[model samples]
Target: MKTVKQGDSGEEIAILNNALTQAGYSVKEGMTFTPALRETVVAFQQQRGLEPDGIVGYHTWEALLLGGESEATELADEDFSRGALLLDCETAALRAVQEVESGSRHGFVAPGKPTILFEGHIFWAQLKKRGIDPVQYAAQNGDILYPQWEKGHYRGGLKEYDRLEKARAIDREAADASASWGMFQVMGFNFAACGEKSVASFVAAMQQSARSQLKLFVRFIHQGGMLFALQRKEWATFARLYNGPRYAENRYDVKLAKAYAKYAR
Candidate 1:
């Protein structure tokens, strides 16, 4: 809830600087919100639909927290001390999930835009429920769900940014809800499931640190009644519920098992 702006100097400045760097800006994390930091803030504000005032306020703070950067050192999830304590279940279990879901070891994101995967089917359903016809949309964009993803492959990153832009043009609310975001790939429609009130708020949370993502993941698990899966190491149940019925096609269950085993040590 704290606000930071230009000429600000202290630990918060360094933290903001680090988040900016992780978000792919060439700003240095320092004690002062120097000219370089101001530039980065302005660019981010413009990209995120905020006024380009170069001021880091409450709203921007929320966006940054939910964005693709982190103040935590990205380390092996197997390291028990690394943020896994936030999970009510065994740290290893959550770590295993993190390993498979994101694989973001060195940084929260690739030092640029947050990686995202848009689910066309989910979008289609959301639009239908919202009383918006989807046929015309399908004619324009085939398979928005990106049905072909398999194994380590995916359709995301800037490709998804473009997809979302188009979706926003048609229907902003539905478009935001359609895309799965962050290292966790949480769908925007599942915002409430992730403990957020609105899709926009959820997207902002995704822009924050990994710890925030994990918090949402935990909330999601609890809401979906899948906490037991993590507790018992029920990878099949967890994978199917988390990744959908076709979880076996991607062997997500098996990957979870392997990852859990590695972290269980």
Candidate 2:
């Protein structure tokens, strides 16, 4: 919880306040960790027989996450339903994909946000659209945000927060599309394809939980016209459309084939 206390600020503080409110405590509308927030924390801690330190530590996090039934269990059910509906596959396929992609559904980049792999192709497109010289950008950023992966020192599935932030500086829409989001790593630019209104909404949905991540992924597959490929176990077609035209060289289809075989067994 980032060691929340009075005078602290930002989204984490705001989230803590919201959790307190959901647990039947009052909180002001904002991100600031005020004196009242401390009081509320102490009260909650006291009720749970914890030291009234007025700080959100590990114990507080446990209480907040598991207080009223487990969100994890609920999210898992949603993920399975959504995956089955969209991909026409069972949980095994989905689990295998998750295992290959992010190691786990909870492999978060930030609190409540899934890790992402930034796309150089999307960055080039965004830069060209803005009339910005991508070559010049690559020259300055050292390929960390461009077509050449090595220039960025990226070694597959690395967290690209700096790259994403740079893209956001250029354009939010492009930034959203430039990074693959969630357990499925669906590109953010696919927000509309995923049935989202904007990048912000897509990011918020991505931050909601793994269930929402899976839902977003299903929508992406459906909108991209790749659902049939997955349904028929045509990993070549699915990987090509979903991963890009270079999926063959990347062996994404082969990987998906092996993952599915492991799960289908």
Candidate 3:
């Protein structure tokens, strides 16, 4: 809990907010530090083998920097191509579920028959990369569970239309491809600049982006700062920093917040 000196960017402050919220600490929108926040920050420092000074200083920052290294290492061992595929598929599935939750009146669109298999395979592979047993999770809950298709062909029925639509929604959300590619669709970016225009190429870029985000999150947590303070998480804040605040709030922030809370944890 050692504190920063004057004139720091308060990066550590942003990190603190992320870690606190992830660990179930109550935080306000502005990341204003109250007496309780200070106490919690101090306690988190102590837990992480930092000094108990209640200030986010160098030692705490150092530990935070190192804490996510192992997690990164684990991710590094993954077959990223396969990982991307799985992530895309799971995203589609989750989106489908979300659609149901949202009460979309139309029958859920099934992700492309071929695409579903591709997405599911990729998702399962990614799950394995993270050391999560996808089969186990699939078996436990019918809704959240991954659907099993024979040779990637889903048997159609009355209720299935709804289910497929839900799955398609998840695919769209999970897809790392450009917006022009459509839901769970990967393509239509400057892929040639990166190397190739194949799905594999797109997957590689997506993985790189995902890895970058993971690094940023770890850095934020290590610095013991508030991401919101830096205009990182709040839709308006992110919009102001990256895009326009109004667009960020209206289009991106809420979705990102949901994903961050849902998948990044």
Q: Write the per-residue lDDT of candidate 1 for residues 54-105, one digit (tens) a residue.
A: 8887446545644444455344443333234223367778778777876764
For model 1, give the 10-residue run with minimal summed lDDT. Answer: 145-154
lDDT of 2 by residue, 1-265 (tens): 3467888888878778777887898878888988888998999999988789998865575465334433341245444543563354666666656766666667465676468877776777777776777777666665346664432445344357766776677666766777777777877777888778987899888877666676677667656887678777788887788877887777888888888888778
Q: Give each model a TM-score.
A: 0.64, 0.64, 0.24
What lDDT would each prediction earn against the true structure?
0.69, 0.70, 0.38
Better of 1 and 3 by lDDT: 1
TM-score of decoy 1: 0.64
Steric clash pairs (candidate 2): 177-188, 177-189
Segments of candidate 2 deviating more than 4 angstroms: 1-78, 148-152, 155-159
Off by over 4 Å in 3: 1-12, 65-265
Worst 10 residues of 3 by lDDT: 108-117
